[model samples]
Target: MAREITGFSNPLVKRVRSLREKKLRKREGLFLAEGLRILTEARELGVLPEMIFLASGADPHPLASALINAVEAAGGDVIFTTPDILGKMSGKDNAQTLIGVYRDRLTPLPALDRARAPIWFVAQAMRDPGNLGTLMRIGDAVGAGGVILVDDCVDPFSVEAVRASMGAIFTQTIAHASWDEFLAWLRAGPGQLIGTSLNTDQDYQAPAYVPPAFLLIGNEARGLPAGYEAACDLLVKIPMLGRADSLNASVAGAVMAYEVLNQLRRTGDQGTAPQAPE
Candidate 1:
């Protein structure tokens, strides 16, 4: 059903607005994604938000119409509101005309399909939402299975992270697990865990990456812990040509991810080399 909302006093408005907070999002099991383009991407990818808020006076576009039709077809609710109320819901004065409230669907570590794609990105103890979003974008770029967060990290579904993902949040699979859980799951599968580290003497480009390579990126300022680095199947380093000690976490991840992606694509990823016939 469609309803027109004239006031910001509605509990739904406040409820969507509070999704920007971690605690509120945790309790509600919902997250807010604002912007017509992002929601359209979701729609095209078959993800319809449970509830949609549209600006009552906004100009119509074909994509927007498509999104509305798709949402309604999926038995989703559509609420028409003023731009001001829309802004309140988005925590922005110049918010987009469209906003979506989606239920958070977290992929548990055990449920992750190891062979969904050739590349997978893993982040540990990451705190920055923008960095987290960039990681998701990288995963989407390389056609990765997903981006997995190891240990405590930023909430990927947060408004900032989702906005920064620029719609890749819907394209890329997002999952979470503790260090122990992730290690056990990866070991039980046919995947290689590769970590980006400064302590390694191996250049990032020198190694042959296995398919389903799990690219591990550490905290922004701290890199990977010594123990975590030791657990990796391989450790490689991006050389520093300038005065900077290292690249940014997301930048480093892109470099490593692309190198492995190119390798896998070029070699056709024959898996581990077979032992020579006896």
Candidate 2:
């Protein structure tokens, strides 16, 4: 049977509310995911929630049922509470009766993985949670290996980010690293590192890309750091037809990702470049 917490002052309610604050989330090593879609996606992503809270008055919508089932299958418990309690716990202007407290997920990249080679997106100092989430979803559509976030990027698990990703959050791998660590990793990489910059002399489509390649997308407003441009093997830019100076970070990232995919397909069509004289 599901447990019931009637009062808004319940201890569990306070614990759940704390997740909304960054300090609390970090201290507890847990975060809250609102709505059924996010919770369901979390389950599919192999993230098991410790507990899920469902609002008493909110009918179990189909999406909610799916999320409840996932939680049950994972041997997790679900709690029921009144709307008043939910509002208190959620701390959102628009409260969703359903909320999940999931285990933190962090996966390390293996050494030069073949399956991912020729496609990777690097987010350097991207601070917007929404933009980060959208980029992850875009990466998924284009069959990207994963996303590498430099140290200054926003928390992928932020509430706004989870909503923006629309469940794509569960499908992508997000690896975080310091700038120095990223530089070292790039140096040992499978392909060259390409960065986007205003001063870039070459067009994005100019190069015939190789597999295991990486395209760097820096901050949307400030662009990439000066030192980073020098570190990259090649600097490239997207051609802008309109008056806008440049595309949004997420748009720029998706464009570059598809470009790499297109080149790979084109290379395949050309047929293996004929084995050299044996």
lDDT of 2 by residue, 181-275 (tens): 87887776456688877797699999877766677888978998899888888888899889887899999988888887777676663122222
lDDT string for model 1 (1-278, tens) is: 68889887998888888888999999989888888889998888889999999887756688888887888889999888888898888777966569999988688777888877778899999999999988888877777777999988999999889988899898887889989888988999798899988798999899888888999999998889999999999999899988987788889889998898778657767333222112
RMSD of 1: 4.7
Which portions of model 1 miss their true places by more than 4 Å?
270-278
Per-structure clash totals for the candidates: 0, 4
Give Cα-based local distance difference scores for all models. 0.85, 0.76
Q: Cα deviation of 68 in candidate 1 (Å)?
A: 1.2
What lDDT score goes with residue 253 in model 2? Answer: 89
Best by TM-score, which number? 1
Stretch of 10 with least lDDT, candidate 2:
269-278
Off by over 4 Å in 2: 57-59, 93-97, 109-114, 268-278
